[model samples]
Target: MYEVIATPFLEDFLVMRPGKSGGFKIPFHRYQELRDTAGDRPCPEWLAAATRKAWGVELSGRSADAVLVREPSSYGYARASYELNLGCNYDCPFCYLGKKEFEGLDWEGRETLLGVMRDAGVVWLQLTGGEPLIDPLFRETYGRAYELGMMLQISSNGSRLHDERNLNLLTQYRPYRITVSVYGATEETYDRTTRRRGTWRQFRRGLAAAREAGLPLRLNVVVVDDNAHELDQMKALADELEAEHFVYSNISPTIHGGPEALSSQSDEHLRARKPFTGCNAGITHFHADPFGLASICKVGRDEQIDLVAEGVEGLAQLPPIADKLMLRTGGCSGCALQDKCGTCRPLAKRYQEANAPLVSYCQHGRR
Candidate 1:
């Protein structure tokens, strides 16, 4: 019966019941009109009924109900990326996580955190890696969120998802969506990207098991220089599986601000990427590290606010802070190399070792 309200950046308002796993989206302009109507309005019966019908949950009136008010801005936080734990099995060359040190809130703490986020107006929660399936806290946290009706999204490498236990877990919780990163279409390409042989076979096996279990699955291909040739094959494979797919080519620096992984970005990768534009980090989206530290998003990892210490109430204090932190620097404000620049301030800062280099983030042809 908890009410979850989300105002996504560049999008509309999403009002949901996480305990029921159902919600609705409303345009910001219309939401504004609704917000002006005033005092603690009870959710419309139609919305509640539609939600319950969609997610197959009853509104028991156990959790706190939520209603959005006119905040300072139209965009409100709606989505959150929860890094259950940073430990991953695969060693992808282009991975941004680097070597993750395992740390996160305990099961009880995780449960509390979910409730806090729900209260704070987050409706869409993306459970991500290293590999969310491998996280020790995954099952408990996921099961609890399912019980509470959180619209969950999972990002995984498809390594452990084939296990019968994991497949059954997916069937039980029924996440709204599951995104698996397809490293390559062939074993050789997979090995080249992951540096792990025979993982392609394991990935296929897991993907089949998940599909057999009827899990809602989506595919994402990491378009790296090494796998650039296999893009067609990857898309064909996704088509063969009848799964929705997308390609990721923007290779940002590692969390440690190192350039070693940047070598994976090729000229083709640079050409394929869309131009740097505005980000919805602090305004509409956020990321929580394994240690319960929250930030605007993954790119802004360095600028973090401890969620465990401040609680949901602390979430209110971040938008203004994030606005201040989004400034461009290192001669990027009006650079003469605009024609060659391939990244924005946050990325430029990371690639330049926090110095904000004057050149593009891509080192492939530039060097």
Candidate 2:
């Protein structure tokens, strides 16, 4: 699909600042550097076309900085988890999706999901699951998703894409983002971690199919202790495929290093957990499960602290879940990281022993 596939510049972007000991680290220099570099680069013609088709925007008013910060949430004008079930078949110990049997909504429920996305003004509809390719409704749901005037983004385990029918159904939409999960670059480590045989091979083939289908792909490398050293190699592969690469933040906690404790073979330094260290979950982007909605990180979906429909748009609904959002160990009230940190409640509970600060994050003094 990409015969000429000319390389693109990676210098125009910068990583999000990691929280430092003194205070939240904001890389103003990198931020400014990106802003200056952005104006010089001609935005991709395809991206401009995608944005215009999805949201009917001129794409001329946009800036690169806005693209980076909100890119995770949307592809351009389209923003949402539309057509998404967010389920996963593999039990990656570190998966923030947590463990659950595959579940999905009937047609009516699916419409409700779309309704919320419309309310949120989403232009791109993402269809994810415990491997969306495995869903029985895959073709029908996918067709309907694009019919809603939302560009399709599909996240898959890559195992089933080998089926020509499945591949054909997906390629028909002309997906804007196709994310495939690959834990380890090498087959041994990848298969061992997943406890499933031939996963890496299937993943590679799926990626090939995506490229053949002319889909823009992004590869997700969950950084665990095993694959941490090859992070550069993974990035290299991404470059070779001309696909974007992302190192997913760990979902499991770091306080405990046992197999169960260490969710995967990635290298992730735990971020400090401070009570008053505020999170942008409810305010910025919230996570929702079937029951209701989680106010904090996606892992906190089980806790179901806040309902997305309860009238909280941004920072206003945090107080309702304040207690559940607290640090169990030192019980921080005003730790500075409170505002900038993910403060993933599950990480704290999973990593720390009963009533402890999350192992991956900083501990505030007991209130």
Candidate 3:
């Protein structure tokens, strides 16, 4: 097991620790020096000093192979999100995933998928799902990703954060951050929104345990009609836990192009998003579902590459797919407000397919 990871991050170089947030950026020359050092040699003095200063750990006498892992890649993607499985313990009416099927790759397949991600140059990885913490292979998958030197962020509903096994694992190999969703501040509202009794107690316990364990956390206030009245209280709850928070008011159609989730949108709370200025989804990052199918991003799933079959080489097809998906075709093509449109092409297509009201996605509808 290595204590630090030295890798290339797009155009820059970074030295990061598995469980720590933020890392030291080093010049090309310094990275070269570390790369040139033989793995069997003692840790470089400068690296030892820097590691101690950055993470309060001394690596003076350890071999380079034991104290550090150098990750070099030819691919371009630097960040990615993997859905361990599409299963959940709670059934939130507003879930974009729609059908929450509890099925995914087995342990062997998952290990192979993680390796493929590593080879594809994914340094910042997010492990998510309907609820990733509850995946049967969550521990194995998480531990493997950590050992592979990816800085991880977990997206969850916080229902399982209180589990003794989960807490122990997370504490030992900490994630950079855990983003938990807040549906409501009170038990009644929370349980009602998730359509599960006792979910409120479980969520509360999970948050408390994660906090006590000193894990980095961020809260996403999921505002919906069912819990819109508790918006302020939800924000206050985040403040009470002293976690960073974000408000998510806009709800979208389900991934399968169903308008069901749109019914839960809190109209008053829905805010206009900034104009789409473009993103580096396929060029710099991508998303992987449970079956190891890679797409440009979460929203644009029209064309996918099967990583399980094609391996890292399959990622080469993404940039072109992304270009095609981003064009404002269909109802958006040649629209006068194309430049000022807030929704991206792929997402807009979903709303159109679902027959979602124009107000939900189009500037024309707002008029």
**How do the residues 1-367 of candidate 1 rate in per-residue lDDT, one tens digit apiece?**
2444333433455555333344567676646654554345555554456556665544433223443332433335667989998888788877888786677788767877776666555657899978888888788888776554457888999988887777877776577788999988889989878988878998999888888877778999888888899999999988988889988876767877877677787556664334566676787778888877888887777668777777877677678757765666654566655554556556666777833232335433355
Model 1 alpha-carbon drift over 4 Å, by segment: 1-75, 336-342, 354-367
TM-score of each candidate structure, all chains considered together: 0.78, 0.61, 0.97
Query: 34-81 in candidate 3: lDDT tens per residue?
Result: 777747778888888888899898885555654555567788789999
Worst 10 residues of 1 by lDDT: 61-70
Clashing pairs in 3: none
TM-score: model 1 vs. ground truth = 0.78
Residue 33 accuracy (lDDT) in model 3: 80
Order the candidates by TM-score, highest first — what do you get?
3, 1, 2
lDDT of 2 at 70: 15
TM-score: which is higher, 1 or 2? 1
- The models' CA-based lDDT, in order, is 0.70, 0.51, 0.91
